[model samples]
Target chain A: MGELRLMKGNEVLAEAAIRCGCDGYFGYPITPQSEVMETLMARQPWEETGMVVLQAESEVAAINMIYGAAATGKKVMTSSSSPGISLMSEGISYIAGSELPCLIINVQRGGPGLGTIQPSQADYFQAVKGGGHGDYKLIVLAPSSVQEMNDFVDLAFELAFKYRNPAMILTDGAIGQMMEKVELADFKPRWTNDELIEKCGSWATTGKPAGRKPNIITSLEMDSAKMEANNKRFQEKYRKMEEEEPRYEALMCDDAEYVIVAFGTSSRVCQKAIELARAKGVKVGLLRPITLYPFPKKAIAELSCRIKGFLSVEMSAGQMIEDIKLSVFEGGCIVPVKFFGRLGGIIPSPGEVVKALEENFLKG
Target chain B: MDIKDIIKPENLVYKKSELLIDTIMHYCPGCSHGVVHKILSEVIDEMGIQEKTIGIAPVGCAVFAYNYIDIDWQEAAHGRAPAVATGVVRLNPDNIVFAYQGDGDLASIGTAEIIHACNRGENIVVIFINNGIYGMTGGQMAPTTLVGQVTSTTPAGRNVDLNGYPMKITELIAQLPGTSYVTRQSVQTAAAVRKCKRSIKKAFQNVIDKKGTSFVEVVSTCNAGWKMTPVGANKWMEENMFPFYPLGDMKDSDKKEVSNN
Candidate 1:
């Protein structure tokens, strides 16, 4: 820990990026997440850490910029909201296809198109399933609190480079705007050229040295046979990630009969809902998925054997319930999975979630 | 002198650049891409920056540009080369960065990227090839297509009402305050090739000087796309394309005053 400071989630992310030796940040402003860039501009990381902070023309440009910087084996990141992230979908595919390691922070707002500035977890499907084209997946870290927002910034970068894939901090407006006291991590220095060459010399284009062929970073494989082989390699990497990286937390699930699967803000609400449900003798527990892609399927399936039913609490009408269904059914033990949610910036209260759980899952 | 003796270093008048690979270019015989590629490699080799230069290849005909240019390269999505170059140069400011794009990639789909990159005055070079048609996709009308030009898309010569006027993108770029140098050149004739090479060198040199957004637009010809013989296409480009996209330096902030008009 470096210093304890009260900070907003978006601001904490910016601070963590600078302290984590982020080499560059390229982004365009959108609602509910503009502070990420605003804070970086205010901090003037260029002077402090020699990090390059640029306000890109648009989200499309920003993501492609990440692709370029990451090609050089540098730590670069970008921040956007729902609409901006959608615009960056094409570039994100390119980044994923090229297998560049970088961080993207999506402080999600309500969507379908310019829906609202308030918080929503509607982007769960897009983040976990790969928002862009092709068979790919971003290592998504869902941060529910301001502290987690601060912590996940470093973790996301770590996982990104560990697997040589793009990582996303899938947060929402509530976490981005709220403030909390956080113990900041110690600062790390940016990697020197020699260090980059040592670590990423196999793939990164850090300028060709004598006696070696030039490194070309591109996703284009015109030959269909070769392209299929490349995709198989990516699939193998994704499978390894799934085995090693599925993360989640089970609260009060040791002897519970009914369970609630949630994440981000909804998980916080579920925390309160569990207290309410337990007092009413419902014996409900909460399973908060931290990594949405390498989804805690094994944990959820194991719980399904013990629990009577599961209620998926979410900010959207129902996005993550599909994954819950997949997990519960994987073991041939089909427990009734219900969804209680709101949409378009609507935040369900603890009382509402508890009532819905009782009416939907606990009644029978 | 014997044949072997005549091939001595002192007697040799010209040799291809080592920076260019021996692989055959996919371009047609008289297409300007090969000529342009050769000149670019020549400049990089002569400037002794081959090892330090990083090139961004666009998604047009020259997407395989990395195959020929023996330097660190990145192949960008169509029209995203400038945005990609922006990232490359910002992170690796010590290296020479440039993007090779055709009209369709730069002027049509990627117009905003190029404009904003130029406006921001990013310290990178842009090599734009205006062949009045999309060559790789086969004979489609490009944004730089001449008025009253015939193409697969504009079968009945381009009409302003239906297709709008051809974009004079180089002239528009020269007006941006961020651009330090802007020139429109061609490589149809031997003399023209020499001038075009000079323009390319100046563009690269401007980046070394830390001057922002040096743009070199080459009024090239797509012989196959234009439905003409290689020799005829060169002559036609001289007559038709030059009048619209004239050859010469449009702006040079290092030498003359620039207006952000």
Candidate 2:
């Protein structure tokens, strides 16, 4: 087994990427997540692991670099915060529409603009829902701890290639900057680009020969009928993924009367709220989404029958709450729903969530 | 046979390798992209890195560079090849990485990426095409376009006061401590073509030897964008452009030391 070490989420992410033999990394320097680049640069990964690391001019260029490398079926990735992710939308859409498999990390910060340097999960809609244009979805994994940083690197690669889709780790500044002991896997899998070329060769631009079948890597579908067919294929694949990959962690939901809905750092906050609310003789429990896209609807919908209401507490301006509401009982049931959130990296204290839990569920 | 006559197929003189993308050329009849692509592809073939090489295309005429390169090709936003190339080279240092850009893409928009990459001493090859005009966006005043040169946007002529003087990217980058070699050559006539090829080879070699950022600026002509006959454009560059953007080694670390000794 590999040695255990205390590492920040960003550092763990950098190490995990190299350990997994990522083909390339493209990123610009920004606070909170700057440690990702600093860590890679400090390690001289190129010299050590023959890993590629580049400090791009802007987040826009960095994502496009990922776009360039990902086109070759090479395991590639990029990381940015909210504002930078906003700049990366166009390229993200292109990569998705191109049907390329790659990983993207967003150490989320506050904002609809350059919101704040502090941690925020306000990009929930952008991460889970489609932020960029086109009918495409990225498999979003939310890691609450540094240990998950190592596990998610392998998982993101697995899901990316498995679904021919882009995967994102929607972490935040708190997780990115926080240091924690992480368990590393012992097994090392050496990935070769040629193997990917052989597997993903049907469409990859790996230098097709003359007089052979011409291959095109484009999202541009000029023909209406062809586009319709492509969309149908995408929808079918998404449905299959949703069935196979619903991941989440639930606590005491079996006997609880009220469910607290959250993900990422906000979920961690709600966990504390759950503990306090229980001590105060309240029957509130927490539901944390690990995979935000294939949302944990099964457990949530089941709990809707037993619970009085669902408190959707988030770090964003009520983004994931919509998913929670839509997932459990849809619009039919008056299974009451309420939201509490703080935008632009200002997190609601567990006291706030506990207070809301008391006022909304316990009192009623 | 000097390893040149191993192939049995009579129609193909070289190895039966797919090192070039099979596609139609969108460049004008006399644009230098085709020639430069030929030379680059030849080098890629000779080096036997078809599977382990990646190329970044600029936003100019070569935006669809993925269409021409056989191995792996990525298109960068205009002037961002170095940034993209940095990402690729950093992730897989074993792979041969290069970025191709035109004047507008390199000297104008991508200036930050190239300069910072050089300053940081990134081991990537940057092939800058100085065609004296923005070929992809139609002819406009360029960083390399000389004073008094009339481009479409310039109308009557490029005014020094209004447009400022031409920019020398190679000379500027060569001064940086991070850059080991910065060369300026043209791909015009046969002799110039030889020099241009040499610079590219040298830049690739620098990357192989783990030298810092290797920059090669190739002065070329955009006949269509300049609204001149291909031959006239070549002549214009020779007479008017070459004086401002003088050809030859701007700075080479080893060459400088050798000459000093």
Candidate 3:
């Protein structure tokens, strides 16, 4: 087994980035996620793995840095919280438009405008529905535990480069701050310059050699027909991801009449709520969505055929519930899809979730 | 002699830089951007660094700079070219990186990005074109717009109370310790054009020597934005612009005696 150690979710993200052979990390410190850069700084990964870590002036600068580095065909990333992520939205859009591969981590905090420092999943709409302005989608991965935090780094980079699209780890303040045992992956050597040319030379902005045309990474297309074609190409990519990338976990769903749809910290709470409801003779199960963008719509559609209803529990004012409802509707099922959420960073307990499920889906 | 014989190789005294593509530029006639693009491409060719050079194209007229220069390039969002260059050069130290930006992009919307990238001593070259007005957006007033100069946004001429004074950002950049070389030059005359070319070449060499951020501010003219003929704009710039934004080497780490102007 790999080396196991107790670490905070944010810290494990840093360790995982280094162990996974990330070439560079550019970030601006924000609360609840500052440890991501702090841990990297303290470890001095440049000394060990030749990784370059820099504290950018702002989220705008950090995200643009990711754009530049990613254009050069390097594994680059950045991390921030809600407000910072908002600042990065424009740069993120540019990155998406340019079709560069990179990772962005948003350890979410409450916000309509700097709402609170505590955990909230309100950025769901922003993360999965093209956070930046464009006809594009980020491959959003929701991690519930510190272990998933450690695992998703490599996985996100893998998927990002595979599709030449941006990927994000949509975690929260709770998981970012909480300490848990994580098994760190082995040190993977960074791709050499020769390997980079072999893999990304087709499009990446590596310096042009003689006999080859210069590689220009840009999103601007003055021709309307060309721009529309690019947009269609992007939509095709998202559709491919939807078909091949949706990941979900269904617990006790085989025999359940009522299912609770949740993700991240909320999903963990639903697992406990499942046990509580089962003990009380209520047949409830949990359907946890791990990839929020390429959401488990098919799984929910299949479950909608037999399930009585779906109760989406979240830490925001009913965001994921919309997706669940859409799934049920797409499945052509006439089942009730309900939402239960605590807004402004309040996480619901198992008993509270069970009560919400019963009040929304049960009771004559 | 036949026309073909006159056009033979021996008769040709000069040719366009091979690094420049054959595509026609969209820049307006007499716009300094074309001249700057020509000189930059010539520098890359002369230095034989075309294969090891990367460029960051900023928003504005120069956004299509990658189309003209035959080198690897990443087009940056408005005013964020410096930060993008930081990322490119830091990861690939062996590659020479440079950012091309206009006044509105560098001095206004992207102020934070430019200042911080310079302060961090990123090993890259910055080609800052200051024409004192936003040319691509129909001559809007820029942060570098001179006081009492009339722009589309300032039809009654810029006022000190409402619009603030013109910013000398090159002077500010020179003060940053992280910067190894800072110079302000123009391309209005043949002699000035030669001097500007030398300055650009020097900036690129600094990157090779591992010197920190090298900034070259080209005091340029936007004839259409200025609402004047090409010849009139040149005369106007020499008379008014030269006083405030003087042409000289402001700072150089290699020389102990640094000139303020």
Best by TM-score: 3
Top candidate on DockQ is: 3
DockQ of each: 0.82, 0.23, 0.91
Model 3 clash pairs are none
- Between the candidate structures 2 and 3, which one is better when assessed by TM-score? 3
Mark the regions of model 3 whose C-alpha exceeds 4 Å error after superposition: B1-7
Docking class of 3: high
Clashes of 1: 0
Candidate 1: TM-score?
0.98
What root-mean-square deviation over C-alphas does model 3 reach? 1.0
- Candidate 1 Cα errors over 4 Å, as ranges: B1-5, B257-261
lDDT tens digits, residue span B131-184, model 1: 999999989999888889999999999999999999999888988999999988
What TM-score should be assigned to candidate 3? 0.99
What digit string (tens of lDDT, one per residue) describes model 2 on residues B54-167? 677777787776677676666665566776676656655667788888889889877877888788787888888899888877798888888788888888788888888889
Two-chain DockQ for model 2: 0.23
lDDT of 3 at B84: 93
- lDDT of candidates 1 onward, in order: 0.92, 0.80, 0.95
